[model samples]
Target: MIKNIMQKVMALACSFIFSTGLAFASTQTAVTAQLVKSEADGTVLICQYRTMKKIHFKVLFTHQVCPLAIQVGH
Candidate 1:
């Protein structure tokens, strides 16, 4: 009767809601990783570093090897 039709409609409505929620839950966000800095020849490589994903800030760091270790005197 009408109850059967309403039952089906309710089921469909619930399924639609659930499916859309799942789609949003499974949404993919593209995160990019780029080489931020580097030294000549060979030294250090800085990268992703928490990637600023869901975070509001980025981290910066420097690495030196072999040469450039000495701080210039005043």
Candidate 2:
């Protein structure tokens, strides 16, 4: 009947909304984590590619440094 059809349509709409919200939340969390990691690291590297119109940047943390480099003098 019409009632059954309405129920199915509502269910579909609710599910779609829920899924979209979840996707947005996950993306926000990932960006926050990346920012935190970059801050914990001291140095920042930036690179630009003119032909591709792209830019890349990274923050280097202390733990990421090579132990061998640190021990080079010792």
Task: Name model 1 segments beyond 4 Å from true.
Answer: 26-74
Give the Å error, residue 23, model 1. Answer: 0.9
Model 1 over residues 8-51: C-alpha lDDT tens digits?
99999999999997667533534433333333433433332223
Question: What are the runs in model 2 whose C-alpha is more than 4 Å off?
Answer: 26-74
Q: Alpha carbon lDDT of residue 69, candidate 1?
A: 22
Best by TM-score: 2
Supply the global lDDT for candidate 2.
0.42
| Model 1 CA lDDT for position 27 | 38
Checking candidate 1 for backbone clashes, the offending pairs are none
